[model samples]
Target chain A: MRTLVDGQPGTVVPVDDRAFLYGESLFETVAFRDRQAPLWSRHMARLDLGCRSLGFQPPRPEQLLAECRKVLPESGPAIARITITGGSGGRGYWPAPDAPERRVIQCRDWPGEIDRQRSAGLRLTISKSRLESGPVGEGLKHGNRLVQVMAARECARSGHDEAVLLDQAGSIVEAISSNILLVVDDQLMTHPRPVVSGVGLGWLIDQPGLDLRLRPVAGEDLARCSEVLVINSVSGVRPAIAIEQYRFRPGPTCRHLQSLWNEQLI
Target chain B: MRTLVDGQPGTVVPVDDRAFLYGESLFETVAFRDRQAPLWSRHMARLDLGCRSLGFQPPRPEQLLAECRKVLPESGPAIARITITGGSGGRGYWPAPDAPERRVIQCRDWPGEIDRQRSAGLRLTISKSRLESGPVGEGLKHGNRLVQVMAARECARSGHDEAVLLDQAGSIVEAISSNILLVVDDQLMTHPRPVVSGVGLGWLIDQPGLDLRLRPVAGEDLARCSEVLVINSVSGVRPAIAIEQYRFRPGPTCRHLQSLWNEQLI
Candidate 1:
């Protein structure tokens, strides 16, 4: 993997960086091919909105792209992660108003297993852990992800590819690292809030010939869906074979969505 | 400020450190006077339990203390922070089972404002943010503190010393950085779970001649309490002057607890 911290080639960050101390940061993971990030706009839009909401000065798109290009491969598939953090400061949760934003762009080879899992379908389990509700930065892709880390550990222990997380009210929110999508009555649906809104899902929803609706998926509602899909920027679209007891097979809609997602990566 | 990463004097951490990436870490803040950390044992007990729960190898007490001593002042009050992270690794949330834990010990001057607040009493406000519910590491002092960070920002904006956060069900959990204490009917009451089990509060409860009860505090219960306080290792005890509309004054019980806390600090 290669990294650039604020355009400097380094992997170390100051201990006082608020991201390291209080998870005061926002991040985006984009899948790129031939040094081009197809979802760059979507990722940046989210990052810009997050920076404004969190009170950090948003990075300029031109400079950020230049930094990202420095870390990308010449002509192959890779993953680019852009992290914007409240820069190093004194000991406190309230960020200093004058503190600059620390931008770190990292590039790594796309894991081959994601492709295998995408093709073979994923074995998923519902996690026992629940997420916090309401509009408290839940839709932002921020650094405070201990809940997802624990849920992923649970999936790894259970020999499952992914784990589904629910809110305290038993409403299905998302997967460990992806957005939850349901194909109900031949229409695609997903949770509206209390989740990190996915860049990949947003792109897919914008594409022509797609029928999408935003709705909360209750625990019982999982059984009502014909197919359950997990979507993320790195792994475009993965069909879930089973979530504990409920079983599913990759259907025509799943194939159609995968084709649409694949076409853009090229 | 002075820092020792793995016992080496440094202020930078690798970008891949899980604590920086996924908030996959636990931390403790200790207030030391003349090189003596009064709540070291309690902090270590909490860290050990958190490591076991989250699957990290907990650092031994002796080595941790030695590193902390390297950065402490010889004769004045200072704040020491011990951070244990899932050390540098590949791009993923699930930590490697054999991955080594990273220990970071840092010391800084104790903020004098805490002393003023403890004496003058604190203006508190109820935060709009609600915490996640259930037994998902709510009582642990881990690095996943974005919710607290945002709530602290709210307090700063509203000109309050601290902000009280409730759980999704409107049950009072804790303040941004301290545990909540309610002096109700001549007895001290605090939430049993859904709050960072505080070392300072623990010591106060364990001391002689104090009545304590572990119970949930609903939003409505705020009016019933005659006094409200915030307790933490760094600040000891701070009486709340007000929480939104409900008013409180430093009463006899608050003074008694402060006296007991002060006796040990010396």
Candidate 2:
């Protein structure tokens, strides 16, 4: 992988960096095709909001875009991750007001199996661990993600492709790494709260042709859904084949959405 | 400060270390004096429990102790922090089963004003940011400490010595970096739930001479308190002079406890 730290080439981060020390950081994983990130603006919006919430100076969008462009593959599909840390500081939780921000841009090969998973559908399971809504930085993708890490570990342990997470109220929040959408009686239904919001889901929701509505989704609501889908920036869209004992066939709606995402966005 | 990573000298951590990537790690801040950590065993117990909860193999206590010893000053007061990360791994939240645990032992100068703070008492305020008890790892000192970080930020912004946090149920949880105790109606009360358990509080509770009792402490209960104190491994015991508009004097109980702590433990 090609990596840059604050636009300089490096692989080592300071031990006292706030991101490493106190998890004071934000990141965006953008999928790049032909040297262009489709949802760069949306990713920047979220990153900027996260930076402000975490009390760090947001990086300029042009500079971030330039750094991402520098790391993107010459002409192939690649995933570029931009991590902006609150920067190195003293051995304490209270961040220095003037601490400089550290930005890391790294480009790696896109997951080769994304297409296969999108076409054949993914196997998913419900996670026993529930997401706790904090007073701040709830929807934004900040670095403190042990809950998601634990949920992903559960998915791996259960031998499933992904895991669905619920909030403390047992309301369906999102997938471990992506946002979830369900089709019930031909209406697209998703959880109203963007708890663990996904950049890909934001982009997909803006698409003109999709029938999308936000509603509180419970386990019973999921059971009534005809199709289940997950979306993230790196993996544009994938259908869930099974959630526990319920199995779903790859549907035409998902295929059409994937095609639209690739043709117009990618 | 002196530093070691996995028992070797190091000042840099890998960018992809799970601790840095997803906050998938646990840590302990231990107080050391005269070449000894007073609450070493208690810290190790908590760390081990956290490791188990996070699905990482716990480090041998003997090895961790030895590392801490290596960084301690020959014969002075110091603070040693033991950070056990899930180590480096491939680009995902689900940690590799064989991922090596990374232990970082760093010794730094003990806060010089701790004694002064203890004698004069601390100015504390209730934090607006409430701690959400998670389904798992609620009491563990995991690396995902954004909640505490935000609380500390609140304290800094409000110009208070520390912030007392409450859980979702409006029960007092802990201070930003320590556990809290209140004396109400001549009865020593602390929150029953170890929401943010501290090694110092655990040690103090086990001491035979203390009149500590665990009960759910509410906001109204705090108003009826005669004395409030915060305890942490680094800052043995310090009285809270004020919480919002409520004023508290440096009571004899806190002074007596401090004397006992210094004489018997520290």
Candidate 3:
């Protein structure tokens, strides 16, 4: 893991940084390829949207992009994270009426199974913990993530690759880190929600003959699906082999999202 | 503001630090008296409780005390902050099982008119935003704070000194930063929900004469109060002079809490 602070290489943060104090910040994850972040634009757009939605001004894009260029080695796939915060303050929730301090970070060597899993598939667990629902803050990767953190812990404890999260109202939102898309017969239908549906799922929907379905998907509906794919930037689109005993054979729709993702990124 | 990273005088937080990524952390705000912090023990206890709740193997108590000693050099009240996180190999939210990274930070300053105003009074605006109410991660000053951040922003925009928050069910919680207490004639009262009665508020209640009346304090009920005080660690206690059009002068209860608070800290 490497971090560049205000354009120079460094570590540690301000004591009063509101990100740590209040979780008053926004963050994004991007896929790095050959010394460059492939989905940098998408990640930044989402970050910008989140900051605005929550009322914040992030660091200038060029400054962030330049810093990212310095840290990302000309190499294989890795994860690049950008966090912009309202900076440190006293024991008050009101932000200092000024520009927030920005924190951009990148972590190297994760899983080492990106290509292997893309070729094979992943197994998911239906998490008892639910993703937050409502219009105020759904979808974007804001800093307050107690629910997702719990769900991830649950998946690791249960010996599963990931967990599928339903909203508080019992509607499928997304997996812990990836979006869930089901393939039935030839249709690529995914649970639609008022919450997050970011670039990865949007790209998957754009694939030809994918037959994207946007409706409520309950955990009970998994038994009727022939194939399922969990989507995220790091993992692209991987088929779901089993969701707790119900097995899914990898289908062509899964392969199609993969090929389209490759074409889009590489 | 002066920042020293591991005794070096400057500002730059390491990017790989877990507090930046996972929001896995805790902090303590010790109110400064001439050259030392008042109620340091209570603050330390709350920080420890937060660590215990977050499941972070607590750090050496002496080390944190030493960090505070190293930072304070003057005779003015200030806020001392400490953060501990499990990071490196940074899985974003999924802390690496057993990585312990702690950062202790101290800020030297108090807000404007905090002491003087506590002697006089304050005005509070009831916020429409609701604090996330639950046992999963409630009350601990962990970083899941977008909820409070939004409420704080509205407080600033609305031109109010503080904002009273409620739960999803319209139950009164606390001010954005302080524990709320309303006095009707003689008996003192406040809402006793854990989400609002964080460690700071809990300690404030144990003081004699300032008996805590546990009841649901609604928006309608607040207007009928003869005196109100927004209490917290740093501020101690400040009488509520006005809320919208409703007003109250500093009375016996507010004066008693203020004197008791001064005796305890200043």
Candidate 4:
């Protein structure tokens, strides 16, 4: 990966950084096309809200963009990860409030399969690894992602493209790396609890004609939905081929969202 | 802090390391006295269990010890932290199963006030930040410690020595960095759910005469306990003087445990 730690071209960060030590940090993954990140503002807004929630002095968006620009490829498509962490700290969980937050910006080659998988429809499996709700910074895209890591591992071993995580109450929370959207009762909806406010999902729901609703999705509801889709900043929008035994064809709504996504970013 | 990355003297790790990227790691904090780590074996045992649970090939205890010794102080008291992480990976949560794990060992000067505080007792306050239960790898001392960080911040800001965390059901889980033991109904007990399975607490309960029972401790039960204590490898054992409005004096059992700890380590 091409990486920068605090704007310098490097791939290492101080081991004592609280993010490395305790996972006390926030991050955003953006997809850049021809050096332009269409969802950059939404990603930054989420990061800023996360900083305030976690009590870190928010870094200016312009400053973060400058660092990201340093590592972002000048042409074609790429993936940019912006990580903000409280720098090195003494041996404890208590962070020094005045410590300057550090940023690690990394750029990676866009996954070549994303475009092919978008229309092909990705496979999704329900994972035994559940997302714990009510942890501090619940909806924020923070660094404490072991749950997702484990789920993703399960997906890889099971030969599925992604894993859908449920909550303790058997409610569908999200996929390991994306948010869930489904057409139930012919209404477009997403879960209201314990999920990252996905940048791509946010953009999709905010489009001029989409009437989006928030509802708790039970695990059993997967089989009932006519169409299921997973959305994220990196993957944009993807139709799901199957969620366990429940198979979903790319329905009209799914194709419409994909077209909207392509029109904006492709 | 004196440090070593995989037995080599360094304070930085690759930014792509899953430990830094996704909090996909296990860690143990040990207190070393005169270059001796009394709880080293227990810590290693916990780390081994964690590695197995997380599907990482566990590093040999001897190798980890050699790395710790490289950074441990030649004499006097110090704190040693051993972190094991799945090394650098690509742009997703699915860890490469064959990737070699990395270890970071760090040693720090022991807090000078620990000896004074052992007998003086620590003040504990209930925190608004609750620990989420049922996340995969629940009881492992993993790198995802944001919940504790937020609780510790609450303690530091509230002028208390530690903060007590409760699970979603309002049951007492543990203090910010330690496990809780209490004398309720004149029987020594500890909560059985969603805690780190503290090494120091294990040693104490294993002593010849102490009978330890596992029970779920409700938040309302603090006031009914005869005495309350917190235990961890780094802190050894400490009497807690208060849990919010509930006051606890160092009772006979607490003093006996303290004497046993000193006799074995000091």
lDDT for each residue of candidate 2 in A30-130, tens digit (9 for 90 to 100): 88889887788898899888888888889998998788788787898988878988898744777776779899887878888898998888998999998
> How high is the DockQ of candidate 4?
0.82
Tell me which of candidates 1 and 4 scores higher on TM-score: 4
**CA RMSD of each candidate after superposition:** 2.2, 1.5, 3.5, 1.6
TM-score of each model, in listed order: 0.94, 0.97, 0.86, 0.97
DockQ values, each candidate: 0.62, 0.77, 0.41, 0.82
Ranking by TM-score: 2, 4, 1, 3
Model 3: per-residue lDDT, tens digit, B1-266?
35545445555555555555656666666676564765667766766777776667777767766676667656666666665554454365565666655555666567777867777677778787766564246667666667677877888888888888876766667887788888865668887665634545666777666567877676777667888888887787888888777888888887777777777667
Chain B TM, per prediction? 0.95, 0.96, 0.90, 0.95
Interface RMSD of each: 1.9, 1.1, 2.7, 1.1
Grade the docking of candidate 3.
Answer: acceptable
DockQ order of candidates, top first: 4, 2, 1, 3
lDDT string for model 3 (A63-164, tens) is 777767677776766666777777765346678777556665654555587678787788788888766563256677777666666677678778888888
Error of 4 at A123 (Å): 1.1
**Could you tell me which residue pairs clash in candidate 2?**
none
Candidate 1 per-residue lDDT, tens place, A1-266, comes to 39999899999998888888877889988888887888888899999999887888999987888887889988889888889998887446666757788999988778888888887899989998887653367688889888888888788888888998888778888898888889878778888774788888788778887778888778777777899999988888999989888888998878988998877665
Q: A1-266 in candidate 4: lDDT tens per residue?
A: 37887778898999889999999899998888877888989998999999998888888999877777778778888888899997777448888857888888988888988888788999988999877775688789999988888888888999999998988789888898889998898888888874688888788868997888888789898878999988888888889999898988999988888888889867
Strongest candidate by lDDT: 4
lDDT of each: 0.84, 0.84, 0.70, 0.85
* Candidate 3 chain B least-lDDT 10 residues: B1-10
lDDT of 3: 0.70
